[model samples]
Target chain A: MTSDLIAGTPAATGEGPQEMRSRSELTAKEVLREVGSVLRMSEKEASELTSSPVENDEEQTMIINMGPQHPSTHGVLRLMLELQGEKVLRCKPIIGYLHTGMEKQAEELSYMQGGTNVTRMDYVSPLNNELVFSLAVEKLLGIDGDIPERATWMRMLLSELNRMSSHLLFMATNGMDMGAVSMMIYGWREREEVLRFFQKVTGLRMNHNFIRPGGLAADLPAGWRDDVLTILEGLPPRLAEYDILMTNQPIWRERLQGVGVITAEEAVALGTSGPILRSTGVAWDLRRDLPYLKYKEVEFDVIVGSYGDSFDRYAIRLNEIRESMKIVYQILDKMPSGDYRIQDKKVTPPPRARIDESMEALIHHFKIFTEGFKVPEGEVYVGIESPRGEIGCYIVSDGSPKPYRLHMRAPSFVNIQALPHMMRDGLIADAVAVISSIDPVLGEVDR
Target chain B: MSDAVVDSPAPAEQLYGCVVTYSRGEKVIHASRGNYIATLKKAIDDSFTMCTDLTAVDFLIYASTNRQLPSDISGERFEIVLNLISLERRERLRLRVQIAEGEATLPTAFDLFPGTEAMEREVFDMFGIEFEGHPDPSRILMPEDWEGHPLRKDFSVGRIPVQFKGAPS
Candidate 1:
């Protein structure tokens, strides 16, 4: 009878996630690993924290699934929570529901067309994704140092603005997650203005794919500066309004201040980055510490938090919008005049006007679109600061037009690892706030 | 450019028995499976606390036109790349460990960097490169019952037949 039943199951035939085993079924070591205890503590220390004997523990603690559907999860992030009444005993994040096999798809797409695939991974900050992938490809092509001044500054400008827009979206969702319903409207209202600027510049609000390998797809549109200035000028008072609405509110402070706490040591060990890392009082911003592009040239403060909690994460992001604004102001002051992209004929296609007039330019454009430019046989990893965290792109080329392997080191994917640690011992109600604070984009996590 | 090659001890010539090589301005450390865990432990002690990214690449011969590896290290069917960042030193190190086709397993880095739990699971799911002693040791992205590793070059990208409404045979 057992054999007959086993024969019909998906487990015997290959279908379900096996990672969601109950905490009661897990071994002591497995529980430790699941809860992210090995992050800071030794095995003995980890065992001591989790191995405390409980009377009727299994009876008291019931296993429950929190989401793969909960709106507060950001997207399809299913967490299996072991709750001892109201307190969460253990939590395991069950992901991959949004898996579209993007890395595998990237292997099929040419380097020139790879941006479209990566851009969709972290949809909120698609520009950063494209920028990192482009930077890696450029490095492999041995033209890392040759990208024009205008292009680099333009990349910086767009990236910082994307950061602002992403943080604004976070403000909306984080507010909605915390039950401040109207703050959602206010946050989205501010963010749409940024996206409006994006649409004018990139022609699409999200997944623009405007930032390309050799340089951007095109130069900044006429009066683009004015549009950017408009956004830069308009955001402060609205952000100050957010300060009034959520930042200074007593209920907001009570809900987030001491909840979802993590330490600097644990945060680093779990490989959390961006606001999560900075929230732990570590001033480890990729833009400042490891300068990429013209980040070294820009002037902006890296916002950090003293306590690694939900409130700290929220405050860091809120302040980070201001910091990004600071960077944008400098970008405007120092926007240089030069070619928007490199003049290299091998990687960059000829100008559209040139194609209309010259036969050779038309052929070059055709070849680039169809076959794509070949990158040298080398591997390069380029990491940049996306709003969520350190988004890195690793590409391995085999003297081909397509990437042999294109891997995006998604911040959400790594940051999600720290969730169990953060949620451990916290109340079930606070879990929503914790997830909101992490600000994971499931697209990137699953991709 | 060749003449300007630094005569001084090549900054990080060797890191805990792993050969350090520079690839396009980034530092890479090549470690065999034997010393991979030990090197990682030492790397932690050396202040490379954060494991920024962990991924694997399947270099099946049919798809790979060329490979650029250091002279001494032989290329393999699968390579595990771990990008570690040292916050104190403000430096990044890339550790590449090559795993042979048949013996496709490496000890888990979970004991040191618990952050690698998900990444290890992803690698196992994608490339079928098992991280031995991994806590969960189950398929992550792909369903547990899924057979072939999707990221491997040999694995065919199969598609389901999309039957249009009112237009099926």
Candidate 2:
């Protein structure tokens, strides 16, 4: 029964995306298939066989495999490294182990179904993925400027909260990768608070498909204002404590400072973004630089650093968490009240009462479920200040329910390009430190 | 002049019949600056600091022109889009330029905005849109052997089947 059911399913049975995603959801058959793909290094073995070894040399280069399971990679990322003594002569990030084909999957689903696909791409910060995709689709639908102001503001609030939680995981994991296991305890504890806020709003912790095309799933519930305020109020003191515990520590400073530096030019050319790019003194936060939502009305600073190194990335992230805290505070102080999602029934389903009373409302609902709303023939690019960086989605709607072209400009994917440049000419010890600092969530990268 | 191509068409004549439209298909403003992305960028760059996003729209059925722009970047191309955002104004603008494929190669935003470096690479990666002087010209996303630009209108949605093992192996 299970095998037949799995066969009936679409791409979930595919031998990819198991790397970043938990394999528990997959049956034993699925895992075996993915493992086969992982070990299918046909080209590698052929190249290795053709190469001649140093017959009488005093030294030899060693090739190594680093994770799809290793901890330091942040997700199920595998690295092929050629080590000359302690120096890495070359490194290739073997991705697609977590290949969800999110962009492809999104094309099969309607615009309404798109949130489910996007939320899984950058699983850590699903709200961001949802927001950019929805905004782009809505732009294609020509309802972008028509969203209720309150929806836009709340979207910003939740997205900022998402950033805080994601960064806390980074804080925890970076600590663990560096052997500061105690810091992991602190990081998860802090991240849990942000997750609590997420749960209060969206009902799910990790993969909330709450933010959808046209607007959000539901309006801010009762006591959400108080809950958000409390979370915001509580963050600053913890940030200061984390600062003292991590940043000011002499050992932490040494482990991080001046390690894995990428210059501004190189970062841009290689597509490094988020804290990694800001660490080079760019001050180019998408919220400030390219205002979205009510971000223009809110007051915040673009956190920047002088050295584009691991220490700088670490510091910028810490400061950004605090900055996100400030934005949440502002949202509480000035959030407008109205319908959360747009009132456009063509894109958004009408109120439940209308569904019961009006035949047209029932028809709209059925059509939305079956055929989905058709976006006009056009293309749009919408980006947001994801914790990782400028998480943008470029959508092309060819008068179809499914997007013609759906490509995500995942910040983690772009930022990972700088890894080879930063990891070069550095000791093996710096590898973990450098990778941790970039805070790449490969769930997004492979998607 | 191998690298340079020019048409001596009268700028006034080209600008004569151009129309511009915005939200809900309303013409917010219209003015023609002949046929270069630079002209559009110049008209707006004074307000918008960043040429943040650039991509093309394949108006398969909607576009009046039956002639499709060639997917190749080196050839002259149109049916293109350039999105501009102003950090100061808190506004975003999208500029459209519909040119034939061989007439492609819109002016580079690399000079107007430094951030176009990666975006141009993405355009090249998916749509095969090339920036003539792009600093590094290599595939940004797909493997080297990947046959076609996935974002092109013609690429089909291919499927992959799955299988798995449960317990730790």
Best candidate (score: DockQ): 1
Interface RMSD of 2: 12.1
Tens digit per residue, CA lDDT, model 2, A1-447: 244333433222121121122233434333332222112334354345432221222246555778869889987877666566887544556655675556656768888888888899888899999999888887778788999888888898889898899888888999899899988998999889889878888898878889888789998879998887777777778878888888899999999898888787666544456898799887778787767788889898888999898999988888888888888888888888888898887899988889999999999989998999988875567778898887878776668788866778778776775676677657678888988988988888778
lDDT of 1 at A271: 87
> Distance from true position, residue A282, model 1, in Å?
0.6
Top lDDT prediction, candidate number: 1
Clashing pairs in 1: A14-B145, A67-A78
Show model 1 residue runs off by greater than 4 Å. A1-19, A45-56, B1-12, B62-65, B159-169
DockQ by candidate, in order = 0.43, 0.07
Return the lDDT, model 1, position A21: 70
Per-residue accuracy of model 1 over A351-405 as CA lDDT, tens digit each = 8899989998899899999999998888889899999999999999888899989
